[model samples]
Target: MTVFLIRRLMQAVVVLFVMSLIVFIGVYAIGNPIDILISPEADQIERERAIEALGLHLPMWEQYLVFLQRAVTGDLGRSFAFSTPALELIVERMPATLELAIAAMGISILVGIPLGMWAGFRPESLAGRAIMAGSILGFSLPTFWVGLMLIMVFAVHLGWLPSTGRGETVEFLGLQVSIFTLDGWSHLLLPAFNLALFKMALVIRLTRAGMRENLLMDYVKFARAKGLSTGRVIFVHVMKNIMIPVVTILGLELGSVIAFAVVTETIFAWPGMGKLIIDSINQLDRPVIVAYLLITVSMFIIINLVVDILYSVLDPRVRLKEMKS
Candidate 1:
């Protein structure tokens, strides 16, 4: 197990290095530095001085080396557009994005697994058919459109929640809380639900399929013949064995849920990395863009690593194989 973990960690490091190199080169290739270098009012000498100051005359390789060194030291440089440290700007916005992702995943897990179990139990039942049909419908809709519909229904038409911003001003536990923090939960209802809808549906379908397959195994029949209750035969005897693969799918899906939340965040005007990245791109804020990409890529690598390690823990067979090797 330890050896497997170490091997994964080393691969993760290499992948991150490659990702950084790609993003760095891509940003550099987008345009001439002089476009941002020379202001409209600057004279020729002044423009040349600015170029020299920024090392625009250096070879592309040399320029990339300098940028990479600074990045390694946690100095993403100041944002030209914001006049602020790029790292600082990203950190400030990290919480909102993380919060949204976590909330979405929590909701998906809570609702998805149960629905999946039900559908798997009686594949031909009315409830199962309805759940399967809903899952198909959900899988077909775009996230942005779902988010819009949620806003219209819950915020604009019904007035059950705020349309935008985290929440209304409120005091909690003697501390003043921002709407996004306090009433923010209320506001999350629509966005989080919208974000989770498709994920939950997919999970339900996968779980149902896996459960059905597990039920037909000889061990399940043996458990039933041994006088085990139907529930026990299905859940304890069948579900446990099939959960290994389902867990892997759930982990990978969770990582994707975070990655794809960018679109939902934008539609709702949520203050998260997604909106920040969009703004930075439009302004050509190189530092902020690089920092955001690094953080996001790092998250994916870390999540996948965690999922790999979990496989061994959840299934002793994996750990036993590792030990023998």
Candidate 2:
């Protein structure tokens, strides 16, 4: 297990290194920030000073080295647009994004699994068919569109929820979180639901498929033949077996949810990392852009590593295979 973890950690380091190079080069290629930062009528001397200040005059390799060095020290540099530490800005917004992602995933898991289990057990029933049909619609709808419709119905028409922003927040453990406050939760509901729709559908389908497969396995029959209660057989025996895939998907999807919540955040004007990154992009804020990308890549790598570790824990077969390798 230790050897396997070390191997995975090494692989994660390599992946992050490659990802940083791609992000740095890609951000540089987009367009010089100096063009947007300075007035068009700015003279050559002014342009040169700005370029020098930003280290743009250095060779690409040298700039990358400087960036890498600073990054290693947790200094991601300051945002050109905000003139603030890029990491600080991102950290400030992280809570909202995290809250949204967690809420969305919670919705997916809580609602999807039970419905999927029911559908898998009773595929021919009316309720099961309805759940399947709803899952299809969830997949078909776009997040932004769904967000808008939600805002229209819940905020504009019914006036039950706020349409935008993280509402009232309370400081918990030195971080401001909205989940504890009524106003905050009301504001959170629409965006979280919209963000969760597709993932919910995906979970439903995956769970249903897993359940159907597990239900037919010999152990299930054996459990039944042993006179175990149907509920115990299905919930304990089937659920444990089916959860391997669900947990894998959930881990990976959590990363994606955080990364891809940009659209939903934008639509809802949520004060999160996604919204901040979008603003940074428009202003050509390379520091923030690079920081965000690197952070995102790191998150993905970490989540995947966690998922791999979880696989071994959930299934002894996986642990044995890793040990053998």
Best by TM-score: 2
Over 35-113, each residue of candidate 2 has an lDDT whose tens digit, in order, gives 8999999999999998898888998889999999998899998899888999999999999999999999999999999
Q: Which stretches of candidate 2 lie over 4 Å from their true place?
A: 320-325
Residue 119 displacement (Å), model 2: 0.8
| Model 1 agreement with the true structure over 125-229: per-residue lDDT tens digits | 999999899899789998888889889898899998876755653555543334345477887777788888888888888888888888888988888889999
Question: How many clashes (backbone atoms < 3 Å, residues ≥3 apart in a chain or on different chains) does model 2 have?
Answer: 0
Q: What is the TM-score of each candidate against the true structure?
A: 0.88, 0.96
Task: For model 1, give the RMSD to the true fold.
Answer: 3.4
lDDT of every model, 2 decimals: 0.78, 0.91
Clashes by residue pair, model 1: 166-180, 167-179
